[model samples]
Target: MDRNLELMLKEQKTAFYIFDSAVLKKRIMHLRTRLPERLELCYAVKANPFITKEIENETERFEICSPGEYEICKALGIDSRKMVISGIYKTPEVIEGLVSDKDFCGIFTAESVRQYRLLCELSEKYGRKLKVLPRLTNDSQFGIDPEELENIIRERDSHPMIEIIGVQFFSGTQKTSLKKFRRELEMLDSFLEKLKSEFSFEAGELEYGTGFPVSYFRNESLDEDALLEGFSELINGLGFKGRIILEIGRSIAASCGKYYTHIVDIKSNKGINYALIDGGMHHLVYYGQQMAMKQPFLSVIGKDSIIPDKLWTVCGSLCSMNDIVVKQLPLPEIEVGDVLCFENAGAYCMTEGISLLLSRDLPAVYIIKENGELYRVRRTFETLALNMPKYERMD
Candidate 1:
């Protein structure tokens, strides 16, 4: 814990997100060091948009799937050239801009033949060749049919503006099963073999979304090195020329951030103790893993921390009963004005949470540079309803 950071936390008037750039750099670098040279790494903007120049330099590209995400990258001044779009719905208007942008030079995922045709139309109109990766799924989710993909490959001569890189498959997210992902890779190998033998697909990139977690909790950390090493073994000597592209979201950013809010009230109902804070569930991140466990690394600031035998449930200020940060947590005695700091919150917390449900002010982000310099990058934003015309009542 940095003393300067503690001072800033105590001085803050509202809830805030604090990110340590040094931690983020270490996390990303640790993974990158073990990856093969042929691997291309991308950071998912939905995880966190606080992309420092150091992070920007480390990342090969970004995966953005929405216009709002595009706006976030634009606001952060991240290069649009390094972004690849992959979403269920690829609107013509958005795709047109992404392809025509002078800086745009990355691949885009076409999940269907309809989308492929749209890309062809746009590329021909713009006089450009669009690089594309066919999204593969089992028909329960977003992906082009395998037969549809093959038909397009067969008719490759018809669409010169679009270049088929390779098929992209997302096995599962937050999956720790090595056997499952290995099987997925093996399946992909066979798929690539058929494409290569029959359709002549070569040097196409496999956009693999790495769905591993960096921080489940402080006690249980995933052995990323071993997992990635296993991935290296699975892909080794598969006879595929295309590079493996990994899109990492929460793992790279989560450990670097901590969420803080001062306790406003303390009460007990029946046998359960509750500590209510100004910041509620809406302002905090709700990771599926963390939510399932109902336990994340939490620090009580401003005191030496006494270990009293009691369980405390931290609740947000929202009136909804579901507005809870932690259902039950064993902690020392906590009181009003004491800060509750949620650890491993650098990713998915603020940006992905339902900040608009109660219309609470969006939490501001304060960044501590890798050099230990601290400053605010973004201020809290008021709700959209607050700024809307109050004179006319629609309801």
Candidate 2:
């Protein structure tokens, strides 16, 4: 840790996550400079809504996935024109509210025929015009089938309040195969051409989820720059003359965050070393990791030395045997108060963890601003209240 960060963390006595806003902006700027300029960058707010305010101006649009995400963007005062409401399970109340509000000018994506129908009904009832993108499924429950999407396009003229602006598609994440991406793009291009030929429908935009891979394990070797280069080449070569939007989340936010936990106990069980940490599976999360079989990016902050001189199995405060952080990690002579720093934890780790399992206290969150000021966003919060119900009379 740097001296400035260490000074700030010295005052924090509990496990926490620290995010660097400068790093976040640098990552976004890197993508903007490397990728095709014609492609618009859409930051998926589901990844890390905490940093949305810091990145709102840097991205062309924000992909809101849920009511909470929308509320976060709205609270940040992000322009509605720079929002794309995209998700599989958009609630009726939320959609109705967005459509009824005359000031809400964001675009909406239809994941299913039911969603399309709901949008049509709400738009007609509220007398508000809506721009929609019908998502095509990649053999998943996330989007509408190609045939069903065609039917919607055919009947679009009947619903004058709804306009089919483009198509939305997203494959799974942790994509390492460039060939697979190219194939998907080719299929999408062909699909757009078919729509143009059959119904004279020209898509004004195409919102695609890149699902870029993040290297969480030490063994995983990924050439991200090469992949982005090839991805941009493929997108630029596409014959579609519509606005192309790349919805990304993990790759942009992962590098800006780090998780910190301190050891509370150390013991030797049956010739095996064990170090108990304050945080566990409920706080630290990494995609595509199983039982700590692979080593993640971690470092030990010790008083004397930061070198690794011993192998220890780190466990969380949870009572379950499955609450292991790492199987066997190389570490220096660690004491009870030594801290462990886990890197690349800025993405889904905050929200995806099984936090309410044992009703453990959620860690504090801090952000280092671009001007080199450390600010605490959230203090250590107790989750037992969320797990327990309020006292009420039995009816």
Candidate 3:
């Protein structure tokens, strides 16, 4: 039975694995090694908590988006003084809680004067000065209008309680264009200069929001050397004395992990074959969403001669029709109980998994090192079943 299961796993691609911290640390170290002395790297905690320790140990600072993430960092014993909070909507309680902590210095991504004033009041009540960075969106889906941003900054400057420390701009997720980034930076620089000259308000800092493209969906021909050079040029041109912060999430984690599953069934009709794995969209939703554009290829694990020659649709064992890893791919001949592996599952997969049905157990996670050492970082059944609420029958 065990041998059969092993063979079945080999036939079906199935495994959800984490990027080993050692590997991720090396990648981050490589990036930081080349970064300018004035620039600060802040790893976005929204990506994965598995690397939080590694990040704290390596980088100078970190970014948080939610209350849960902030609490996680606190629990992990990360230095809260080096953390920055950013989100579209922040509750009064959350703002109060963060501001009260002396170690916590936050930046609320405000869109209006009301938000700015409220945050100021909360900071005053907490007896702590909060650093604010206005979220700038330049003709993009996620940012406020350029004119609206300028207005908000001007309004915030009038209030003695609010301090406009810097400006932040996010171009959107998975963006891979140096030209677009350059344009956004230029717009921000011009606006900042105008604000400085007219209102005599010093734009203390600049934050380029996370959109650094990684190797998950598709690899673009981004010249790393040129990209950094362009970034340096922008910073130099701005001539702002404040520090520069990068909130990067995906680019740091995507290339380091893989999702694995075991094939449960197989079907063939009219020269077309289907391999169904134990896990699907529930485990990795982004893979399914991007299948139409960037289909994942299958490869046999621990087999020397096996190679993919025919295209097959890799589906999950879920009831949903859309639960698929790769809709079509030239895969090797697979059999029942084979293990299927999906690459680039590190970012936004485990952390963002949602239990749609709540019936299937969450997939287990493991980390494999360069020396072939495997560590079970988290278990599927244990974490999934813990704290499930029970309902009482009413008469």
After the best TM-score superposition of candidate 3, give how far the Cα of residue 334 lies from its true spot, in angstroms.
Answer: 2.6
Query: What's model 3's overall lDDT?
Result: 0.69
Candidate 1 C-alpha RMSD relative to the actual structure: 2.7
The backbone clash count of each candidate, in order, is 2, 0, 22
RMSD in Å for candidate 2, one decimal? 1.4
Give me the runs in candidate 1 sitting further than 4 Å from their true place: 1-3, 52-54, 218-222, 289-293, 384-395
- Candidate 1 lDDT at 235 equals 67
How much is 47 displaced in model 1, in angstroms?
A: 1.1
Steric clash pairs (candidate 1): 280-316, 285-349
Cα lDDT listed for each candidate = 0.78, 0.91, 0.69
Q: 287 in model 2: Cα distance from truth in Å?
A: 0.5
Ranking by lDDT: 2, 1, 3
Q: Which one is best on lDDT?
A: 2
Local accuracy of candidate 3 as per-residue lDDT tens digits, 1-395: 23433443443344555566677877777666656767777788888776676568777667777788888888888877677777666676887777776666556666445566677787677666667777776564555676676776667645666677788777677665667877777777777888788767778788877476665444435566666666666667765677778778877777666777777888886876888878777787563355444665335555427777777788776788777677666667777766666667778887676554646777666655545465566666533345566799989
What TM-score goes with each of the models?
Answer: 0.91, 0.97, 0.84
Those runs of model 2 whose alpha carbons end farther than 4 Å from true positions after fitting are 1-4, 302-305
Considering every candidate listed, which one attains the maximal TM-score?
2
lDDT of 1: 0.78
In the range 14-61, model 1's lDDT, one tens digit per residue, is: 888898888888988888778677787888877887754448778888
